[model samples]
Target chain A: MSQIIKQEKKRSFVTAPTAALLSLLLPGLGQILARRVQRGLLMFGALVSIVGLLVWRITLLGRLAEGFWPTLFKSLDRAPMFVAFGLLAIAGLWLWIVIDAAKQTNPNRQFGNSIFVLILVVFFTIGWQISEIDLVKLSSDANEAWVPLSKILWPWEAAVTHDTDTVEAGAKVLVDSEGQAPPVPEKTEGEPYLRVSPRKGELSKLDEDNQVIPGTKITVYGENFEPNTRTQIWWSDSIGNEFRPRYQGEYVSVMTDSEGSFEKELIMPYRLIPPSAKGQQIHKVMARQVSQVGPPLPSQPLILTIELIIETIFMGMMATIFGIIFSVPISFLAARNLMSTSWLTLTIYYLTRTVLNIVRAIEPLIWALIAVVWVGLGPFAGIVALTIHSIAALGKLYSEAIEGINPGPIEAIQATGANKLQTIMYAVVPQMIPPFVSFTIYRWDINVRMSTVIGMVGGGGIGFLLVQYIRLLEYKSAGIAVWFIALTVAILDYVSAEIRQKFV
Target chain B: MLEIKNLTKIYPDGTLALDDVSFTVEDGEFLVVIGLSGSGKSTLLRCINRLIDPTKGQIIMDGQDITAAEPSELRRIRRKIGMIFQHFNLVDRSSVMTNVLSGKLGYINPWASLLHKYPPGAKKEAMAALEKVGITDQATKRADELSGGQRQRVGIARALMQNPSMMLADEPVASLDPVLAHTILGYLEQLNSESHISVICSLHYLDLVQRYATKVIGLRDGQVVYRGDREDIRKMTDGQFKEIYGEEAVRVNAGEFDQGEK
Candidate 1:
């Protein structure tokens, strides 16, 4: 160490002092003066890039600030920790570069880059804060995710329903004294019966503030119902529209006694009658007891899920068939090896490649949106969208496969005095079969996955139903669609793998 | 008979592949070409069949200028001249019988060949050619399934199906073992002697050149530097050998080592 310090002191005063002074002004200037051009440039570039990144981040954090200085200060106020560390890193780098510049002029001293690593660690920490990485929230908010995740994981309960048999009896009631009420029907044996006392009553009405006012209460008597069974009270308006009436925030229901008889009281429900009616509006009050019967059947969501999933699969199949038909020819035009023979053919190759790239760059959902307008929202539109995208994707893949083929057989075939078409048929076509089949199968797999998503843009598949269920807050039903898509994609992936293995 | 006059091929990249090369081969002559890699040996052989169009040359075969033939006429001449490669360029996925039958494509109807419906006797001809190379039983196997020697035999069979007037072998034995090299060359020799087919083949080893060549030409830097008859080749002096190969080139013992190989 002493020898190094003594050698550093003994260095030529003229060049060494000038080099150190130049490096103090700019971080890499001394190194450049020492003829370390590459190392100096690298140091300069790293310093500029890191400082530039820090400035960009600061600007992003304070975008709403008025001007440059205010924005910088405002960003510091908002993210003090990131800004503080960023400034500290810049200062540390500046000091380190100044020391390093002086050290570069000393022949006996070895330069160390450990300070650069320290600067990087400081900036990386600032980046973590700027990106808002929060592992605490990830675990803390997991319950919120699980609420829907559980529904998605197991949704079969909503997929089925039980058939039920109802035993019901009704009694008529008058809405007001302005019209006459219907007479009560005679009670019969071995059947349920309901009778309402003092049937003439006012229906619940909205007041001046539109707040609901409770109507008159009436006692209801029931008999011949199933013993110890719960019976619900339902009301029908003058037009025969039936709905369960809520009493005190709960549906009006009562349990029958052991003798199959009971009595209960319920306020009249609110109903608006049109002024055009000439006679009394007799609303019916009914007591109904329900019993589940037979096996569970598929619910509407389950049936719709199955139907749309099948449509999605067929859309993929049709798209793949159309893609294979169109892409096969286009691939020949796009293959560089085949088209590079002449400038005219080379132009066609570039044109085809550019068009394929443009078409493939657009997502299938975007194509589906355009196709929905063209074909008016059906599986055919989804097929058209997927086919358009598939053609571009498969064309590029097939052309690459063509480019990768062994040229030996092609030369051999040409030497046999075969025509151009005959050469392709015998030499290129045989070599292309395995790859063609593999790519086609792989494309079909992609098309199937894309078809499910295309339906969300009105292209007619399970995704349409899935979006509707999600918007309606039907998590279990959306779960069914998600499950179907996942299962179908997995199965198709396996099938394609098997087919590829068999052929390739 | 064949005649090549002042054949010169300059590639688009300005590579002088063949520089004013001139040679002649009469009927029933086994002419062997010896050279280092990139010495225009393959280029010279390919020029005879018009596979590589010469930049400037005259390839006169039976009073017809092959280099000046149109596409249709060139193909007609190419079918009469069979060529084999060092790599045995058979379609790996195709059956040996199919590969051999394809050699008759020049004579078959275009549409019929496209549909793979050859003339009735074409299969018989392919089998006969295969039998000539002693691989008729392996005709049903795919070309890639065969051993190196067997694949070369298949190549020979495919070439024989053309019934050509001459054969061009471009380093046909380079990729095979020394023993297999003699086996493949023996087949070419049998066809040459039995059918009077003029054979123009490029070879690497000096012993093989001396054993099979009725006449020999050596090339260096795409120019012919040495010519000798069978007896003259057997008695070639070191100075003559150095004239064809560079001064730094040393001939290793007998058939065990390659000479002037890259």
Candidate 2:
């Protein structure tokens, strides 16, 4: 030990100028020359990945790529400042590497110098450029963005149509007054409601008692929607409050036929009525072809945001339930102590552990894409993706729980002449229940968060709705959906923590 | 009555844990087996209940060849024989009552057992067993919530629920303190005398063996080396015990055994 310590104490020297030159050529080369292998590898990896990201973005977009290495050749004709910003970050890392390598020759010297302030300044400047930040736009153009943003947050203002935009959006109203509300096939309440076209050019919206079941599919066809515009169909309860009919997610975006007309079917989304609605099921089918010319009724956007948020929450819940179902048995198989008894069992244990690790390593987003392919693009795909991910994650936790169980009870149960199943129930299950519950709750929390983003891959959740609105720059409705996601996540986090406390 | 003509147990790994052990457990006999840790006392006790299948043996208990019994038939035989452990192996997370009621699992319908629904008659009997161990008050508490002595009492209660004709206790008092050890053995002694349930118990201390045992067997390296009645064991000298236990072994609390408690 003393000899090793003495060897470690001996100092090695490198020329500062030579080290800096090496780093100047390659971001972490000087650090490697200075015998800082880990530091060199980290710096090298970060710089390379940053450059790779820039190349990928520029090449994939093709806007700035008439040739290879556009920035190196053209110097200033980039499509977005963010690509330049990414390049700058790489340069920043390179500068840090050179400075750090030079200081390595003198172990007592600090790496940071006055140049760090310059680096910081440049970093912030690039960040601002990439973000396209404009103080003037914040004060002036904020009005245009805020009008829609505020409407999305305070939904009734933009969602409730003062005119018959819902009817004009897609529906052909064949019945009016008494015929619209009652004496139609669907269930009716006290007054008249706007009836929609159930088939092409036919307007008998009601079924038998004038009431549509929660899962009932409604078809709305309309003429004179702006040609090639995307149209949406929504449902509203008695008080003129509208909700988005998001089956899996936002009704797979129907576009109007080039003649400016559309015919589409959408399911009446479940849990559309809040408990506050007091059992009122009198619903109206309305549609709108999204046109560049006019803004939607404030209430329509507001309600759709709320509806999509709730649907995302439900999607997360379903995924968690499936996660629990699949994880429980796999956990027993995966537990080292339970499955390491014999050669056959030991082989199974390693196989189970390896498979679990592989599944867990893949992000839910990638799983969602796979799920979309397997099941088609809907909330079902989202559920399948999150459930698959959740099973692997929760299986690991449950296996840890099984491995931690006391051996005493197992022996005791066996001594009492209990069979394998009885022993597991009497001994193993009791020890496992608390941890199982805690893991399930924790998995549910994670699934909820994953489901929100899963929609981007067509997994049918609020994330799908969120990505579209963000792409269209409709920040108002987007802001409302973001609020719902934030609220749901916050609630789930609190509830899971409380549940964990109880179990633990 | 149980008869062991020639019982041998060789582990899969080739460690001979028991060899050619032969003994008869007469009706209501409190037979104490004494040996050092690796002398195969545990293997011997387990073989009777078939917890560890003997490598070769014919254990005739009440005219039935237990070694020849099928898995389902083995369970029927096991239900008649209750076993206790040194670690008081009660499920720590389950209630004391639940642990005790587990002893009745063999007799209960498998489906009902899966649902953890003990018949009302079984519940009433579990309470009676707890009363016998003087821990009826702790029945609803979790098994681990009790102190070591109390936990052992729960272990006894759980075994008592079986209403077995014979009990195999593998170093039941090994993990307890001196005072608790005697108290536990006293309960076993009382059960042996009162219910006339034959007990084949492995013990550690000389004083405990002398106090509780009606007959004694001493093992050394998987072979039975000495056999004696209560009086012969009580009169055993240090030199005589050395022959059975080996020269390296030391006696513990030997002087305490001479003065009889009862």
Cα DockQ of the candidate 2 complex: 0.51
- DockQ, per model, reads 0.62, 0.51
**Candidate 1 Cα errors over 4 Å, as ranges:** A1-136, A162-164, A176-181, A202-214, A226-229, A256-263, A270-279, A290-295, A342-344, A369-376, B237-239, B252-262
Instruction: Score candidate 2 by lDDT.
Output: 0.77
Candidate 2, residue A415: how far the Cα is off, in Å: 2.7
Candidate 2 structure quality by residue, lDDT tens digits, B141-204 = 9888999989988888888877888989999988877777777777787888999999999998
- After best superposition, candidate 2 residue B161: deviation in angstroms? 1.7
Interface RMSD of every predicted model, in angstroms? 0.9, 1.1
Tell me the TM-score of each prediction against the true structure: 0.86, 0.64
Q: Poorest 10 consecutive residues of model 2 chain B by lDDT?
A: B253-262
Score each candidate by Cα lDDT: 0.87, 0.77
Best by lDDT: 1
